[model samples]
Target chain A: MSPVLRAFLIISALLLLAPLLFPSVYYYRIGVLVLINTLSVTGMVVLLGYVGLVSLGHAGFFAIGAYATAVLPAYGIPPILTILVGAIGAALVAAFIGKPILRLKGHYLAIATLGFGMLVWMVLSKEAWLTGGPDGMVVESIDVKAPFELLGIKIKTAIAWYWICAVAVVIGIVLATNLANSPAGRAMRAVHESDVAAASLGIDVARTKLTAFIISAVYASVAGSLLALFNRYVTPDTADFLHSIEIMTMTVLGGASSVYGALIGALILTSLPQMLTVFAEYENMMFGAIMILTMVLMRQGLAPAIAQLFSRGRK
Target chain B: MSEFVQFCFSGLTVGAIYASVALGFTLIYNASGVINFSQGEFVVIGGMTTAVLIASGVPIWLAAPIAIIAAVIAGMTLYKLAIEPARGAPLVTLIIITIGASIFLRGLMQTVFDKQIHRYEGFSGEQSIAIFGAALLPQSIWILGGSLVVFVLLVWFLSRTKAGNAIRATSSDILAAKLAGINTNSTMMLAFALSAATGALAGVLATPVTFTSYDAGVLMALKGFAAMMLGGVGSPAGALIGGILIGLIEAFTAGYISSDYKDAAAFLVIFLVLFFMPGGLFGMVRVERV
Candidate 1:
């Protein structure tokens, strides 16, 4: 009945029908990746789009999640429980550092996050004893097919992961939408408009920013844990600087403002590389060019730009 | 004590090179508000171009100038094509643009020069001289002297020359500079060229000691940025002082602690400094009026 509910239904239907249309395990895997990326970018919506804060270090949280699942299983923790724990770990880390880091504005914040991401990458690569030392370690496989078997429906592992990711995304959207409508979300938007102004209105600017940062970090961690479960392997590359940039690019490219925009950004960026295999070596160049052109052409990004075009067309 | 002196000497050598790059960063940041993340790429281009040219039978003397010229052209082109077009964009957008430009330059270099590390012979022979019971390479002296010369020259230019004054004016206030009939656009272009030349020279000087690669630019940029932040963002003297301190810290860290964590020292120092003194050592404190 409501637009939010209607949008959720449409997205769920699309996710459900995608497997039927593609009917390939490979496509399902890519879809799962898109879903995972979409989950993370949705977090970016709160941080970058809502609060107007940028973090170049989210891959650090993503790494923490993946590594927790990879390493915690050895410590006898169940894989499923580890995912939640990983998210919690990421949230704690974010909250701990967010106070000092959030104090920095603009490029200073960017560089600080850059330093954090690089530190994570270095630790993941250098601490070979724990993290398998750059070569990475295998993750314990998750059992998502148990529910499907209980329902008497036969689904391949890839398709099962795809469905799980889809359900997760739907839940993520509902949460994001709910948050967008809440007082905290309004405070976040107000912070985006002007932190000083928000402060003037009696909002605790520091707490609001930290809240956005921690939420976004938790989202990234969860998405990362899901990715580890889906692939059954985790590498240090999962938390590299470029991957951090890629996440940011997707957020900005898709329009950072809304949930749907996060999904679109993830889908396009995930699919574009596969489609443009010939330009594989020039990937960095393309990324750089896209970021520059996007900012110069339309700062609000693709989804918002397209929405404006449609509105203009109606006029 | 000898070991400590040795570490200090090594620190000063690397510090000098970092100072050169930081100076370039300060120049561009002062003239234009943009922190050109691609500054290190100019260094790589200079080193790689010189290496490839020498390998291709060009005399070393001729190759060096040619390499610098090439980087200058690249710098100017980056300004005109990428930065100039996106004037008045938000700080985040500008940061992304510069980062993108850095990525693009690295990719282009990888394609053109392959992924191999490169270095030419130092200006002098590969002889080590003893100073206070410490061994010093001639290349180290060159790197230190070269950076010092550049610093002195920059100070002179900024204080004495009309073009330098124009750049300073533009940096202080673009509108006021324009009203005073100074060409702000040309000043920006000059800033790009001068910074690029300085970066390229640092690369040329340090390559014999540190080596150069397509991917090295990112780390160098990060280190230079850290150095710049340590001294103060836009102050030339601050850049030199900060770079030396970082280099000394790195050398001491490597000497005393695990060399494996030596690189981490820079980031740790950055965090500590930013936490305690956000404006850096020599940076002016600005009061925000809202």
Candidate 2:
């Protein structure tokens, strides 16, 4: 079997069998969160890991997805259709803004994206008539059990969300892995190495970057939509700068260049807080220390560093 | 007209604070091509220290200098611990490190002090000076005057002092300055200290009017960054002009447009300006050799 297929099977088996260890419904909720984060971080892997482009505004797209699910259902739109609408809307916004903003390099690009994210956040918080302001709004949940009921298998709501998110995450991973090995992916890597060199090599550097940006935005949007549907509510904090930073930190901590690394990052960050409630006051300090230590000591991130260590031990 | 004048006065008052913060950014960016994300944390340190000290019955005169010194120490520690270890790291790495430093400092402040918002009495008392039907706080004048004085001192130091000349030489060309016996590392540390001092001073002056918490640094950093970008990245005059322009734009937007979207207006202006002039108003257009 191909490495991609083998990896997929292993991940699928883990997802399928892991529920046996769940003692209660709370763990399932955390499981759904991890899957949602994994889906988002997979997109980050493609953009930051493959293309070497950093976007600090991806939470803006996430908010767009969440708000779409929350607000669109009130306008007679179907709950299922809201996810697509949010993804498409986020893609459009990314493409529209990425053209010019992507032209900036380094710190300038980071700041421009930061500004864009703040704009989205401000609008979401201030537009009380449309968004219900900072108080947020209720999200209409999608009916996931109807199909399962036909098969005579009834599941709890949290478990239903976990399975749904798991399927989505698996599909997302497969698609992302396929893209990572495609010709366009090679072009993206080329641009990552040197855009000038990539351009000289006849690659459409701008188009490639825009493709990655749009894809990542769509991923964030879908994950956000899933989160809103699962929780039955949405808020502007989903698009805040801190959320953006959290996403970036997860991506970097897990190993930006590896798909599995992104999954590991998502799982640890999502579940660690639940396990470490005693250290709640020290959360920010610990988070800061982790970011600094990871950057300073292991620039390649956790997965790659561990892999290297294992290989060296084998040698 | 009175309303307009009132807005202008408030604008200048806030603009002066932004200017000092921008100047801090300028110092660090020039010395070491790293945009210090923790610049606003220095401001918080200054304001928080002063507030805590004054509440404990220390005179304002004794408290202010101590706060500045505390911020300076924090700045140097950040450079020594986080930045120096990651020397020659990529821009993204540096950005993450500084952001980490800021988060750490914020957490430390939260632990060391309470999360409550803090402010002390203004230096010149609470008298409101009426100008054109608008009541201006006396502290506003202090903030403006303090920033002006800092700016003048900074310019004089950069041009007239030996250490400042070393810093300039190192910023221009590290290898050339090293060949000429300038210690680049010490110069960078000096830059960080000076930047922190500038930000702390702004925090001290503006806190009476603005009131600050442990979390106030992030917004200040973003606005200061916006101001720096609007004027141009590396230029001091650009920092000053950019900050004031942003403040005026924000004030007018809040006055005429929806107050809720004042920040949005500032960012929109930045986007438009970047589109027209990629290098900013006063920034020189960079040419990549590769």
Candidate 3:
């Protein structure tokens, strides 16, 4: 089977087997969160992992997706349609903003993204009439009951949400993997290696980078929508600097070079907190230490590092 | 107007602190090519340590230097442990590492100090002096005097001293500087130490007015980073001018517009500057070699 097909199969297997093994609603809830984060990290891998561009403010796009769902339903648009609206909105914003920002290199680009993220955060927190201010707004809960009832299967909310999220993750992974294999993917990699060289080789480096950015924005937006619907609430915290950093950390920690690595990264970071309650106060410190250690010791991240260790042992 | 005078005074006071912090940022960026996100933590460490020391009945004079010394040591430790270990990492990796260091430091501070806000009495008493019909705190005067002295001393150090020339040479081209037999390691250490001292001094000065807490470092870092960008990334003069400009903009915005959007003004200025003039006001346009 092709890698995309193989990835899909593996994701399917995990989603199928995980519920049976754990058999807890709590686990299902956590599974939903992991899948949501996985979807976002999958988007992040396109920019940071593949294109070699860094954004410290993707939480802005995520927040846009979330707020779109929260705010749009009041205007007679159905809640489900808002996901598309959110993704498109995020894409448009990304494209517009990416034009000038993507022109800058390295650390400059990082600062610009940080500014954008802060801008979004300020607006979300200050616009009480629109975003309901810092108290946050309730989103319409997504109901999966009708479809399940039509199929003659009864499932709890958590389990149904888990399935939805798992499906979304699989779709996200498949699309990302396909994109990676396409000619566009080659151009992105070329740009990543050296934009000047890529440009000399007849690649439109600017446009390629922008395209990657928009795609990543759309992914983040979709993840945001799914999270809002699942939680039935949205807050400005969704786009805070810390949340943006967390997403980036997940991307880097999972191995920005591979799709499977991002998935594993999302899973580990999301669940690590739950497992290490005793280390709660040390979370930020540990995140810092982990990031430093990872960069110094295993620059390819946890996934690639483990793979390397396995290959070395086998050899 | 008296209100305008008051705003200007406050703006200058805040700008002075921002200038000191931005100088710290510029120093580290110049020498090591690392942004030192933990620069703000140096300030916090200084202010908090001073507060603790003073509360424990240490003399204000002794406690202040000890706090600054503590911050200097912390800065050196960050460079030694985290930054030096990950030498030659990409800019993104280095950025993440510094950010991680900042988070780690914040966590450490929180664990040790608890999360309560802390401050000590300003160098001078809290008496307000009237200038242009506006009352300015004596601490504000000390802040202004202290920043001016630091800037003058730094300019002298960078221009006249052998070690300063070594730092400049290393910043310009590390390999070439090393070829010239300059100890690049010591220069980098000096840069980190100087940056830390400047940041800590800013923290010590401003804590009386702004107060200090574990979480205060991130916002200070962001503001200082913005100021550094506004003035041009690597220029000392730019850092000072950029910081003051940001302070003025923030003050004017708060005075004329919504106070809630004051923070927004600094970021907006940064965005506009980056878009229109990526070189900033004082920074030369950098050319990347493929």
Question: How would you class the docking of model 3?
Answer: medium
Runs of candidate 2 with Cα error greater than 4 angstroms are: A1-3, A310-315
Q: Over the stretch A153-243, how does candidate 1's per-residue lDDT look in tens digits?
A: 9999888888899999998877887788889999999988887899999999999999999999999999999999988999999888888
lDDT of each: 0.87, 0.88, 0.87
Candidate 1 Cα RMSD after full superposition onto the native fold (Å) = 1.8
- Shares of reference contacts reproduced by the candidates, in order, are 0.59, 0.55, 0.68
lDDT of 3: 0.87
Fnat of candidate 2 is: 0.55
Tens digit of lDDT per residue, candidate 2, span A40-120? 888888888888877777789899999999999899999889999999999999998888877777676677777788899
Please give, for every candidate in the order listed, the TM-score of chain B alone compared with the true chain B. 0.97, 0.97, 0.97
Clashing pairs in model 1, backbone N/Cα/C closer than 3 A? none
lDDT of 1 by residue, B46-153 (tens): 889998888889987898899899999988988998888888876777887788788788888988888999988887878889988999999999989989999999
Candidate 2: what lDDT?
0.88
